[model samples]
Target chain A: MVKLTEEMKTAFSKVKIFPVATASKEGVPNVVPIGFCQLVDDETIWIADNFMVKSLANLEENPNVAIYVWGPETGGCFQIKGKATIISSGEKFDKMKAIVNAAKPGLPAKTLIEVMISDVFQCAPGPEAGKKLL
Target chain B: MVKLTEEMKTAFSKVKIFPVATASKEGVPNVVPIGFCQLVDDETIWIADNFMVKSLANLEENPNVAIYVWGPETGGCFQIKGKATIISSGEKFDKMKAIVNAAKPGLPAKTLIEVMISDVFQCAPGPEAGKKLL
Candidate 1:
């Protein structure tokens, strides 16, 4: 397990949207743009699923997920990969629901996906690109 | 194979960055933010490899790739999934290298990734989210 560094945390906070990717057990891949992804803690991230059908299905079949975030202003990019768990009714889910409702009203926060970070990688294009940070 | 619609083409043109995802043969997934992704034709896309390590490795093991693009201004998001072919030296590679150099100088355009789009999906959050566009 790897913890997010301060720079990684700051980069993620600056991102308004994230592109999340997941694969089926058969290796078919899917990617979607998510607007409600937030870091719950250094080692944990929560994604409020508003209208995700394929992503949820893929997660059910395979727990592994990768989320890509980039800061437009700072030109910083990072990818966080981890195992995901779906939360429908729980304290974490409730908190995520409330937060999602406050930010974007009327959308049902159908599920909260909790990702436990296993690895972090630099995504910016350079020598360090794709290098594992943790 | 699915061809891109006018709206999808326009949405991709409006994007300055793209988050591309690929999985290895073993099903390990990776996502990275790419700044040099462009649509070559309605059914073809090109991505200049400035500094991609794991993404390239994953592609070698599995040709399937998913690229996510969203327009911040129009609020349109789309995912294009296809099989990728890497071009090291060819007409396509030369064109992509010239374009990459003209757009962002000083970086080596190591490879040109050509994607033959097989499927397109709407990524916007709504009733149609995750719906296959083609």
Candidate 2:
């Protein structure tokens, strides 16, 4: 089991948004910007949204997802995947919203998509990853 | 449906490899380095290998996949998804191999994974994507 440190949380928290990749049964995929993800513990990250996009619908059918978070520089790429457990209305959703609001003030409130993270991995520098391949 | 460009083909062809993301029915995920992917016309990308891993097995059960390609800069992230059409030992397989060999030489031969693309999208700069969310 991988653990998320404060550094990882800080790295993820500083960013206002991340791109989520989702797909449907027919194999059509959608990527969009999401404004909320919170560190639920050392092993969980949450996302909140209620858009009826392909990505959201895809999650209802298939919960598998990959989130890409890249920094201003080329080296920071955080790719995370796990089951997207839909907590539409519950205490968990409320807690997640509070976290988001506290982290990012003045943002509008919306539905939430929480990802119970199973694994998180960071990519090395581009040249390093390429060299390892070759 | 978006079409692939010769420039996109050239951009993908030069690379010797790209990382693949896979997950099991239980929701555990994995990411690995794979050295095979070929542009099949304008809407398909083929990957080959015979590793009995989560990504492959995930495809066997659930063929939904998302591929991320990022350049070594502030931009250049091509996120694509579609069905994984497995074409083993046939005319399509042979054609894909030839393309791979021509694009990259002296590489080891392996099984192929074909992605029948349905949608393709490009990400703008980090600030631009961030602003759209805020």
Candidate 3:
């Protein structure tokens, strides 16, 4: 509902590792650490891959996914809902790899999965001050 | 797949809040946090609800969802995937509401959406020390 600011984006960028949640048709789910996920545009977020694991499989089965960018100890969080498009080879994949590699050096550029966000919002009341639209 | 320990569960419990992500057919996704999500069983995780917003709607349309429990600052994270079942009124709802209200006092029991987890895994490497089976 609120705009995602530059500060929030910078904070997100600093967070380096984010937890990605993926699920299948039968209500089975897997949560794992993703090396990189970046905001491609106002409505899209991309996640890179080394092991084409659960999130990728779940995306192939169903495009819907939820990404949580906060911890229990940390006071704030960002939650996004969107459809995941699996891009193993393409310009989009290349672009994502570049961004990820730039942020996190030395990591191999494996497959990339981009989550085109449909909605973004804050979980807690006041990270409001941290948002600055980029 | 590493185990979820008593410490992880306790840490997750202390985190007080968690992120929930959801999506629909068009590849649009929304992420938000509910007051509580507890491990109902080893393979099942339940999320409570108040707004009944995107996640509830997405679940109704499609049961697939991914929940991320991590922050940029906090070094560890948990990612889980599973099918979401909207339980408006039932024993499950009542049970979830009790668990949530007990942890976070004063919130009304609007509705409870249980995400019956199919898989559970950590997002990082060395919090490897944090897995314990309840």
Comparing 2 with 3 on DockQ, the higher-scoring candidate is: 3
Ten consecutive residues with minimal summed lDDT in candidate 3 chain A?
A125-134
**DockQ, every prediction:** 0.76, 0.10, 0.24
Steric clashes per prediction: 0, 9, 32
Candidate 2 DockQ score?
Answer: 0.10
DockQ of 3: 0.24
Better of 1 and 2 by TM-score: 1
Better of 2 and 3 by TM-score: 3
- Across residues B18-96, which tens digit of lDDT does each residue of candidate 1 receive? 8889988777778887878888889998988889898899888798999887766646777788999988998989999
lDDT of candidate 2 over A90-115, digit per residue (tens): 88878766775787665434556767
Worst ten-residue run, lDDT, model 3 chain B?
B125-134
Deviation in angstroms for A127 in model 1? Answer: 1.1
Q: Give the i-RMS of model 3 in Å.
A: 6.2
Error of 1 at A38 (Å): 1.2
TM-score of chain A of 1: 0.95
True contacts kept of each: 0.74, 0.05, 0.28
Q: Model 2 TM-score?
A: 0.54
Indicate the docking level reached by candidate 2.
incorrect
